[model samples]
Structure formats: structure tokens, C-alpha cells
Target: MLHRSLPIRASLLLAALCLSTPAWSADPIHKETVALTAGKAAHSVKGQIKGYATAEYTLTGKAGQTLSVKLKTNQPSNYFNIRQAGQDEALFIGSTSGNTYQATLPADGEYTVQVYLMRNAARRNAVANYRLEMGLRD
Candidate 1:
């Protein structure tokens, strides 16, 4: 009876060894960049997003990659409305005031980052001078 039980224990150990082997892991995506110029507008820049807005030059990303977005502005105005592929993700909004705005991208795909002036009682159409930076992480 002991000899028969010995074979059963050996088989269980062998099965556990096979299951313990590690599987392959996928690689992480690399960092990328996009640029935006002045003089691009949507319907209007009111409470939602008003006045002239500009978007990034490129919007290509890898699968399963984390995208870190940063927006640097010169002056403190209503510089808001940074979207991912024409969607209102809002990376930065509601008065950053000559500062940098940051956000993270969820998935790998084509994403568009936009910046615009906020339209309110002040109602001034000033030229937008800004820069965008994107990075990747695990």
C-alpha cells in the first residue's frame, strides 16, 4: 500500500512543476510626441469650449501602452479642452494660468490633444501659444 501511494505523490509533484513554469509577458509601448499650432476652431468656445483651438500634430500609440500627456501654456487664460481622438477627455480645463496640465492615456490608438480659449464675460480672442509633451510608462 505504501509503494502504491508513493507513485501517486510523484505524479502530483510532477503536475505542480509543470504548472509553476512562467508564461511569456508582452512588451510595453514607447513614448511619443504631438504638436499643436494656433487658429483651429470648433463650433464655439462658450461654456463647453469656445474660440479658436488647436490640436496635436500626431496621434498614434501602441497597444496596452500608458500615455502621459502634458500641456504648457504661456499665459493664464481659459486654455482648456484637450481631447483624445475628437472626444472630450479634458486633460486640462478651467483656468490653468501659465502652467502645465497633465493626464494619462488609457489604451493604444490614435488620440487627438486639443487646446482652446474659454469664452466668458472677458470675451477676448487672444493668440494661443502652447506646447504639448507625451510620455509612456509601464
Candidate 2:
């Protein structure tokens, strides 16, 4: 009787584990506002992200201003990208090894910096803590 009950116990445990974890679990995208001034202005933010999570920052600058963005994370599978205001695509995409990008503002107005964990990493139940640094150099 004891040997027969062992299999049922293992099956119940497996079902409980599966039910505890959802395929997708995350909050809404987090957003932060920022500002850039000429001649070495900088800003920094820290946050934690779970699987399938994203955080974004918004700022406005002149047409000719140069902007730089860098992200440091506990997990190496996170990156950042830049999207111009009113545009549907990113101006530049960062690689897995390097989560940084710099460019001159093309038409001024507002821009968005999006930080997210890679799709593979986000699919897991891991959480990554990160620090994002943004700056402007005149």
C-alpha cells in the first residue's frame, strides 16, 4: 500500500507546482520621466523586473543634442533601446553584451528609452535588478 501511494503523492506535487506558476505573470510597463540639460546632465534609476516585464523612461531634447543611455543589470540578459517620439520603431538596439546607445537627436521633441529582459530570460521565473544611467553631452 505504501509503495502504491508514493506515485500518487509525486503526481500531486507536480500538479501543485504547475498551478503555482503561471505562463505569464507581470505588472504593467513601468514609466519614468526624465530631463536632459546641455553640458553634462545625467539621470539614474533603479528597478527590478520579472519575466516579460519592461520599464521605460521619457525625455525631451533639442534636435542636435547628443544623448547617451547605459544599463547595468544583475542579469546579463537585459538590454535597452531608443525610440524616437511619434515613431513606431527604435532608432538603435543594444546587444546582449552591451546595453548602451548614444546618438544625436534627429528632430527634437520627446524620446523613449525602453529597458527589458530578453524573451528567453523573461519566460523563466527569474527577476533581474538593474540600474539605468542616462546623460546628455553638449
Clashing pairs in 2: none
lDDT of 1: 0.47
Q: What is the C-alpha RMSD of each candidate to the true structure, in Å?
A: 18.2, 6.6
Per residue, candidate 1 scores C-alpha lDDT tens digits across 1-138 of: 999999999999999977774444322222334432222221121122223433433456554545554556554553534445655555445365333433455555566544555545225545455555555544
User: Where is model 1 more than 4 Å wrong at Cα?
Assistant: 1-51, 86-104
lDDT of 2: 0.83
Question: 1-138, model 2: which lDDT tens digit per residue?
Answer: 999999999999999987885655555699988877767647889998887778989988888888888888999788888889889877878753378777788987988988888878877846889998888876
What TM-score does candidate 1 reach? Answer: 0.44
Q: What would the TM-scores of all predictions be?
A: 0.44, 0.76
TM-score of 2: 0.76
> RMSD in angstroms, candidate 1?
18.2
